[model samples]
Target: MKPVRRRIRRHFGLTAKQVAVRSKRPWYFQWGITVLYVVFGYGIAYWQFAGAEDVHQKLRQTALENQTLHTKIIQVERQLQIEQAAQTNLAQQLNKVQDENMHIKQDLVFYKNITNAKRLAK
Candidate 1:
């Protein structure tokens, strides 16, 4: 293993002492980088998850509103249908009354003719 390392160092034109010194960074620098990565990664993760939660809440609220509006629309449509039926019934009643009125007017004209004829004959 030592011979292999020496051969690798020779190939890279590095002394064993220099390789050892360059391989190990200062303890503080290593710890500082680790701490920074942990803090930044946690912050990013928290922000993403929180934002997703907010979006999910908004979606739920919108869905509820949409459902409510749909129910209201259905209710309005049902009421409109009932009103239309009532209007149709009223129109039929009006037509029947008008027909009755026409018949009464014709009977009145017939009675007037009969009375006038009898008076003229007398």
Candidate 2:
């Protein structure tokens, strides 16, 4: 019984010591891991910055395109307004000409009736 207990204690003590030794790794290995982590972090930061810059450039391009389109739309709208105004003016002029033609036709009829009356009297 005593030998069995001693063997169990020795096994447990060796396990604890192994665990402690593994927990304390060499300084060079720890520094290498820290350097690798720093490099990886820097790489990630650079990748994010590059992506953001690309997005910014795209946004500027889109904004310029939008501004150009907006200006074109304004120009088109102004042209349409001018054309509509000209059409309205043309319609008014056409109405005035038709009214004048109607008046001339009435006068011609009156003159023909007067001439016919003079001929009948003779």
Candidate 3:
């Protein structure tokens, strides 16, 4: 009784030491919650980094494919231009050959008339 009086007097009329009145979680439970938070943070970070790398890889692949297609288009255009020039040259040659053929025919007819006239005179 004297000890209780001394404690009450020392604490200003209350108990000298504090005691928990409510239930608390165990130490292991608190540690488990902390570990779960850390693991969750690491998982989210890994996902972010991996997703960025995947996007970069896809972009590089697309760029490479586009470059290949562009090169093919340029080659085809050059071939088409070359074919068109060749066709034009052939058309010019054909026109020159037709003119020469007509001239030759006229000469043949003139020679025939001269020979017939000479025979008539004889």
Q: What TM-score would every model get versus the actual structure?
A: 0.60, 0.58, 0.54
Residue 101, candidate 1: Cα error in Å is 0.7
Residue 91's lDDT in candidate 3:
99
Output candidate 3 Cα RMSD: 14.4
Error of 1 at 64 (Å): 0.9
Q: Candidate 3 residues 1-122, lDDT tens each? A: 99988877877756456666988999999999999999999999999998999999999999999999999999999999999999999999999999999999999999999999999999
- Each prediction's Cα lDDT score? 0.94, 0.94, 0.94
- What is the C-alpha lDDT profile of model 1 across 1-122, one tens digit per residue? 99998888876764544434457889999999999999999999999998998999999999999999999999999999999999999999999999999999999999999999999999
Per-residue C-alpha lDDT of model 2 across residues 1-122, encoded as one tens digit per residue = 99988888777865544544357789999999999999999999999998998999999999999999999999999999999999999999999999999999999999999999999999
For residue 11, give model 3's deviation from the true position in Å: 58
User: In candidate 3, which residue ranges exceed 4 Å CA deviation?
Assistant: 1-52
List candidate 2 stretches off by more than 4 Å.
Answer: 1-48
Question: lDDT-based ranking, best first?
Answer: 3, 1, 2
Model 2, position 58, has a per-residue lDDT of 97
Judge candidate 1 against the unseen true structure and give its global Cα lDDT, from 0 to 1.
0.94
- What's model 2's overall lDDT? 0.94
